[model samples]
Target: MPNLGKLIVHERMRRGIGPEPFADACGISRQTLYRIETGECEPSLPSLRKIARVLHVSPGKLLDLGA
Candidate 1:
């Protein structure tokens, strides 16, 4: 499986988005975003949906789970 943290960080940076703004866009706290990005926590499905929406990606794409 792809590393979720790396994927998120990569996409975020690719879009020129900072952590704080990305977290706010996702309606999550910056600390939560940091934890998820650091592999310290797994985002819930709803959280994933929110993030995916903001990043213009599907949740499965964010999770990297094969169809």
Candidate 2:
């Protein structure tokens, strides 16, 4: 299993993107994004796509399932 939400936060920080603005760019509420980042909730595929798109990254980057 992938820790996708953690990966999202990690990558965002690695790229110097903050949680609040990143959440805004991803079209999610900051609280929801915080829950996801803190591993409280697993995002749906649609949510993942929105996040990935906003972050300018592939879903696999968020999933960390790439070979």
Q: Which model scores highest in TM-score?
A: 1
Compared with the true structure, model 1 gives a TM-score of 0.91
lDDT of each: 0.88, 0.84
Clash totals in order: 0, 0
lDDT of each residue in 1-67, candidate 2, tens digit only: 2487778877789889988889888888999998898888888899899998887888877888681
For model 2, name the residue pairs that clash.
none
Per-model TM-score on C-alpha atoms: 0.91, 0.84
What lDDT tens digits, residue by residue, belong to model 1 across residues 1-67?
A: 2488888898899999999999999999999999999889989989989988998888788788842
Return the TM-score for candidate 2, rounded to 2 decimals: 0.84
